[model samples]
Target: MTSADGKGPVVVKEGSDALLPCSLSTEENIEGKLFHWKKDGQKEVFLYDAGVHYNNGRPGQDEQFKGRVSHFQDGLKHRNASITIRNTKLADRGNYTCDFPRLQNQTFHIELDVGAAAEPSVTILDQIKDWALLQCLVRGASPMPKVEWKDSSGNMVPAHEPQVSQRGDGTYDVTLQAAVNKTDRFRCVVTQEEIYHQIYAETNVLLPPPPEND
Candidate 1:
């Protein structure tokens, strides 16, 4: 593949679609040609032979990618063979190859990096006389998010060091706890800067009033 398109990994947020680009460097139309796309050089992501495709009931697509991969049919005449993966998952992150086995065995490579899944749930764990203990937890997120607690006014609230663990599926689970001295609407903000994605969940903490004076 030509270096005209600088080599950089395609960044996509988890659960969103990702476009892996590939095309004929010679700008030769490939509408009636055959090309193959594979993941990590193993999984059959998609394949197009002549006018038929794996998505068009051609079959033979890897089970993990079935019904989730698509190609740009209109771009075929422009030498484009790019494919898009819908509802991306962390397991889908890997190196991909676009191959034209018939034409001098021409091949191109692309890297895909699926970002973290955003969705942190906040809940009240415990409440004392004047303070309430709140917990925020994020599960099944990749590349571990920067979890934090903030008040309704957006000021950061002090919290215990986040407890992080990895799941069997290679995703992460993070838990953070904070003690708020006053009743307020608190939020747990989850940020994955690499993908420029941020999400948050909030909860209201209402501490009972102090005991009445004698």
Candidate 2:
């Protein structure tokens, strides 16, 4: 079997459905054959044999994946062993293996990466004199995220140390502050390198002109 991307980890956001692709490379039918899906080579994710499948009451499915996984029966004739995991969580990130125990013990490996991500909220907290204090907030993100300020020209803006806090739900809340002396479009970028996810929020700040000399 081969993964859909053929290479690299499959990236997905938390709470979203993730499709782990696995299909026979020879394009042979596998509807009547047996294939097993496992996570980290231990936990049973799903299994299929002939017409009986894990989702249909076949035993041995890991508790974490039970009632949340499904296979494409219509595609079985096409040799597709892909499975969709609904409402994916951060813990779903791991290496997966699809094994065809009936087909000379053929096995294929794939990596799954799930991230809890959200776009930061940017706003002007206060404005005094010619400069304004801008705030960027990212709430309820897992594995945390790197937050930074940037100008319209893509130049990195210097800012104070970000205030980070962990919520009771195991997610993180981040607050970043920057003071701008000129008018421009400022953006708050949030990146989660582990899952290859990135998002940003932008706001326009207009400063009043300086007073004229007497």
Would you estimate the TM-scores of all the predictions?
0.84, 0.74
**Model 2 CA lDDT for position 169:** 70
Candidate 2 per-residue lDDT, tens place, 1-214, comes to: 2345586778788988999988887757888999999999899999999989887777888999989999999899899999999999988988999899878888888888787886688889999879999999999887689999999999999999999999887779999999999999999999998767899999999998888999
Top candidate by TM-score: 1
Cα lDDT tens digits for candidate 1, 36-155: 999888999999999999877797899999999999999999999998899998889888899999999998888888977668998899887899999999998877889999999999
Q: How well does candidate 1 match the true structure in TM-score terms?
A: 0.84
